[model samples]
Target: MDHPSPPRKAPTLCSLRTGLALLLHFCNVALLSQRVCLSLTMVAMVNRSEPRGAPNASLAAPLDNVKNPVYNWSPQTQGIILSAIMYGMPLIHIPMGYLAGICPVKKVVGSALLLSSLLSLCTPLAAEAGESLVIACRFFQGLSQGTVQVAQHMVWIKWAPPLERNRLTSVSLSGTLLGPSVALLVTGFVSQSLGWPMVFYIFGAGGCALSLLWFVLFYDDPEEHPCISLHEKDLLRSSLAEQVSSGGKSVPVTAMLTSLPVWAISLSGFAFSWTNTIAFLYMPTFISSKLHIEMRENGLLSALPHLLSWVLSILAGHAADFFLARKILRLVTIRKLFTTLGLLPPALLAVSVLHPSVSPLSSVVGLTLASATAGFCMAGLMINPLDIAPRYYGFLKGVTVLIAMVGGLISSTLTGIMLNQDPDSWFKIFLLMAAINVTSILFYLIFAKADVQDWAKEWQGTRL
Candidate 1:
């Protein structure tokens, strides 16, 4: 028998794909900064009563001198404003997810960044214009940013090889955590020194600049990229030949809806979102109330969880790829193992932070570790859609994120209501989050898979 030819491998050199992931990292940074900018600045924007002579002199001095108009919005009102983007997101995710397949993903994502930037610019004016306009602006911003989120899945579909999926997606999506990490670290100082409105102005203008850069750099696929090397192109073409197909086939809507793996991804996403939403949007407030940290310190400290999470997510990506490459476990087993690692520890840690005897330093440490551990899920559910349905990954992502964001909406609203009724209700909140996290992981373990579904395969009979 003739010996089989060795598998083609791309040269170990600078990769356009890695550059693309980095560019996407910046794009994610810009977009998510817009998303969380208000979360941090809202501390300065809302004139909540602090204890007399609270050590927020840095923030107070700016307000006292600049006379930045602070709103006396109630807790419920603040919750509504924080959750406004979630409302806009649901309206656009499914449509944009479908559009990601048919449209130029670069244009869709670039335009979204531009729109989001413009909306961020308008946020202060909208706040001055009235609460409704601010809410409307945020809703539209959500719609715009939602497109970016859905479109990225399409980019991976075209660019990411099967074995490299975890690394590429993790490197790119790490921006999600990194954005908020940077935002929280800076927004407090910006709000204090330049006025709260400058927080929006600065991030919004940066976003617009990034959009221009995106137009110059991003391409939808390898063949379309003028600068891609022949070696890299050939490697991608051969490696991805099985996982992707030429265009024109309709998405198998009914089959995808009925797939248990899809449900597993969606529900697991919801579980993750419930906790993540609270962490991103409310952590500053939680710290202020519980630890009595001032705005500047609050911002710096609040960023630690997400920063640690961001770092660990990138590491988890590499670890995941290592496991996959080594053939140490089946694909489904690796995903499930990582998902368990992601969910169970964090759930227990979240509840631990509620202990009465836990010092302020210990609470912060516990919360930071919990957030860091949760990053493992990025290797789990975040990339599973690509494994099972690369052909319709965008559509699958849209559906999954829509369901997941419902948890965000509910979590924000419920947290607000609970806190509003009784400020000392964090115990209840942590319990609920832990319960949801555990319950969802069990379902994911039972149903999740890594094999490409029948409908996702091309006529060539290759599978991802």
Candidate 2:
């Protein structure tokens, strides 16, 4: 008996649907840029460029209160402002993800991001009004952007072919690194010369524009897209045969809550987010404090690490797909390999920073290398939820994100507390991050899988 021939390969490599999906993912992350810009730009906004009525007057003054409308807040207050987003994010993750999984996800995502941009634009106005307004603005921005991860998963389940899953996911997720890098590079100059308000205005407006463009071009699924090719559509549907949900999945609360794999992924996210939150929120400050590098220079230098991270991240994605396509290793083996690569360098690098003899140049290089390792996570932690539960990808992502947001909040707030104690206090923080990194990876390696969990399929027929 002859077996059926393999389906004929489509002449097209990737269709318009693929391009639109990737670009839409890229735009979704531009919203993340607004947050990074604020973290870096606030430094320039609050402090003068030199010392006042003295040598280096611009740098010496704690505030250019007259020109900059500076807020000379204490570290505790600053921490609260910086971390306000996390406050709203964890609370909304389950709701946002639940809705995105059931609703017209593209519209839901677009509207959420649009609201974030509008809230971002109102930030300057909020600052002008009072600190409370600024805090409220950030809180609301968090609430809006919180749904973004799960919403994108919703899009990807419909768009990524099985073989192309790593590529699409990694490339799209690299936006998380790329957007923030670009924002860091640009925010300081805009804040320094044009004023901090200009940074917000530029990034916030770009996010708003990008969100509208996304709505115009992207559909939630292949069937709804006006421009997708037939072969591409067939490929997507066949590749993701099991994900054809009717948009009414009963939340897999019991399975996700009990699964070792889910818990592993969730804890991994927490560890990664904690280390990254510190880096994201305060790397510039750390460099400035240690090396006396000015804020603009700090911003530019900070960009290098994330720029490398983005490039390496997408490359890691492609590499993972290549290994799988060649049948070079088992899927579980591949994931563990990448997760090992992704987590250890960062842990070791974090440990290096604690050494008293580490030079400024070495410190910077170490952190950059750590970032490069972080890129490999695309092959593992970042994409594993979809691998394990496409049907519940949204809710799985939401739960993981909710746990991770707490990590972010604690890191941000604790960093402020540490900064006040002494420079040596950084040693403890670095040690904590390193411990979290290696420990989380062990949990992932032991419990993670490269196949779908049973719960993802249990109610599919009944719902779809």
Candidate 3:
């Protein structure tokens, strides 16, 4: 009867440890939450700066005179200044990437924001002084912006888990689409009522405020954050341990440049960039001329395609992850399938635009479909760096971006030449861009790989 008594259960070591770890983790997360909340509130206050004129004041004077004698600037001149930020970005991104490899991401990111804010502050003053000063200010702004982009990608790699990488990367990249949405919605109203100078002032001040918050709140790694609980920190560390272990110490810039995979990805990005920039930068102009849409309507309509693009990007990323998790397809197959499908639509849509009998609505729909489809390619090609070398994601992104920049330059020049030759022949330029998009698919199908390559394995072994 005594032997039949129920045995008492013992507390397992793993259970006890997990409980203690969770308790510590929560405490640390609470502290971090408070800091982030405070930082966000401060940023909100900075963003509340009022425009120069009363809210209801007429913006027509500034709007009407955007190309007037006071500035004596053509639309082309203003475009050059606005685009300078984008153009100069690729040039500095490479060096900035190397710096990110050596320096703490938080410092690199924070410093770049600080510098960008400072440069942005100079823009209003420059414009008031002369067009030359404006160009100079924009050039510096481009450099700083490029540095920020590189550093931001580095931060994401350092902080986010492998599984969550695409989602988080989308958040950052979405800014490319979202920034224009904000500008189109607000900038016209702001410039119309307040003045052109107010635009730069608001953006500059906002950047400065964000820089302050970034410095105070961001930690390069979870382990380095003062407020993170030991348990949560451990979780973060364990999740990324494999990736960290696999990534070799940083190689020389020349060696990185010579990497076959790197070159392949870069070349692919170049083709994608050419097609994408042509669609985004020139499509509205084409629409206005061909479809007889007003400037305001054109701006709004142009934004619709990118909205479709943003949605498709999320869906594609999720679908890619799903296939990857089920082991239904290799990463290479996943990339190839999506990228090829994405590229095909643009070419088809470009052909649609060439048809003289196509209705304007049909043409717009075709263009929208093309932009939306192209976004899926980003799910594969844009994310390849994170797949192959999580540690060197920033450096690789920089290299690809530099290559893409050349493509953008070529696209711009080609567009200008085509327009000069025959403004009515915009369809010809689109056809050329469509060819580039199609060629990108061929390159990816032939060369791009989803898995880590021999060089990476060799590098990892040497480092270990």
Candidate 4:
């Protein structure tokens, strides 16, 4: 009998794991750019003929030259449109989370992102048709975009080794901040130079292209990847042996719903979402209204906080892994410590912007610090679901994020109402956010854990 040859392994010159990280980062970048493009573009899209006391001497001439149609949307209307994206997000998370367990997660996420991108392409037309149509487009975009949030976590189940989880996940998630940062920095200029519609077109097209690339390049599991080397596959298999099951199983619904650690993660996510929603969605309006910055410059300034956040997000991940590798701190302690670092100082810093004689520089510094510090949470409660329920991380993430989305939706709509009622209500909003941050961190400290829960291990008898 002829001896059987060993199975062929792909070349190991390029690491598929790192490739996955890069693709995930860009996926977030594409998805988030599409999501936040409206925030900056809205500044240029609105008819601001009447000055609200901000100096516009330099911008008046240039703005007059641009002939884009400007809508007369009130603060309330703008808030509704901004929050519309979140409306459909909650509806899809649980369903998508379940689907990720049974389906090829890459396909589900790629298809959803592609649909969302297509909707973004139609946004300008929707706006031209009516504000309702724009809101509808945003709502549907949220429905599609929401699937990515949950399903993407499933990819990590088979790919991220336990020891490197923080580094991989954080690096991938930093794209969330970087995506919006790039959008805020460029959307105003793009809107001004090529009309507001072009901003949507460029980002939407980019998202669609990325979606196509994901379909081609990414795989649900390392074993399924043709280009993944044998050594890499073996490494992942040994590292994830206990964590991931061979196939999907029904999640323990009652156990998840009753778990304190689960609630801690969900509530912590909610608090972060509330503060982040205010910072990202309303910062442009705040800078323009309070600092008297022009649209182009407003985009630049608004981007500073997010850029810092993107940098710190990656740093926090490295730090978390460093602690874990050295056994410097227990996993639970590390999670709590990072959570405190992320939430508490930012809350204080946000409140500092309420100073009576705050200068533009001081206000910018405060807000930037607030946003950057919050990025530390990426390695804290944000990744805790994976620690406790690696097998069902997708479903757990969906549940937590569903709660978080509610926070984002309320924060946006509430901020809009407050600002509409009194444009100077930012002080009150900051105070409320500070209170929320403190309360959230306290709950996480008291109840959060890093060990795998018993119910989460029932399917595979995992012990990490």
Which of the numbered candidates is closest to the native, going by highest TM-score? 1
For candidate 2, give the lDDT: 0.77
Per-residue CA lDDT of model 1 for 1-464, tens digit only, reads 33334355664227888888888988899888889978888888776774323222222444364536566577777888999998888788888877788899889999999999999999988887567788899999999988898888788776877777788888999898899888898898888787888888989999999899889998987898999999889888888776653364666777788889999988888988888888889999999999999999999888888888888888888888877777766789878987888788778998999899999899999988887777888788888888887777887799899898889889988998999899989999989999999999999999999999886775433222
Where model 3 places Cα greater than 4 Å from the true spot, the runs are 1-83, 117-125, 193-197, 227-231, 245-259, 460-464
TM-score of 4: 0.92
Candidate 4 Cα outliers beyond 4 Å, as residue runs: 1-14, 50-67, 246-248, 459-464
TM-scores of all candidate predictions against the true structure: 0.93, 0.91, 0.77, 0.92
Ranking according to TM-score, highest score first? 1, 4, 2, 3
Candidate 1: give the clashing pairs.
none
| Model 1 misplacement above 4 A | 1-8, 11-13, 50-67, 458-464
The all-Cα superposition gives candidate 2 an RMSD in Å to the true structure of 4.1
lDDT (10s digit) by residue, model 2, range 177-261: 8877888899878777777777778878988898888888887768877787787778777777866552575776876788998
What TM-score, to 2 decimals, does candidate 3 have?
0.77
Provide the lowest-lDDT 10-residue window in model 4.
Answer: 51-60
Higher-ranked by lDDT: 2 or 4: 4
Q: Model 1, poorest ten-residue lDDT window?
A: 51-60
Error of 2 at 199 (Å): 0.5
Q: lDDT at 29 for candidate 4?
A: 88
Model 1, position 424: C-alpha lDDT score: 89
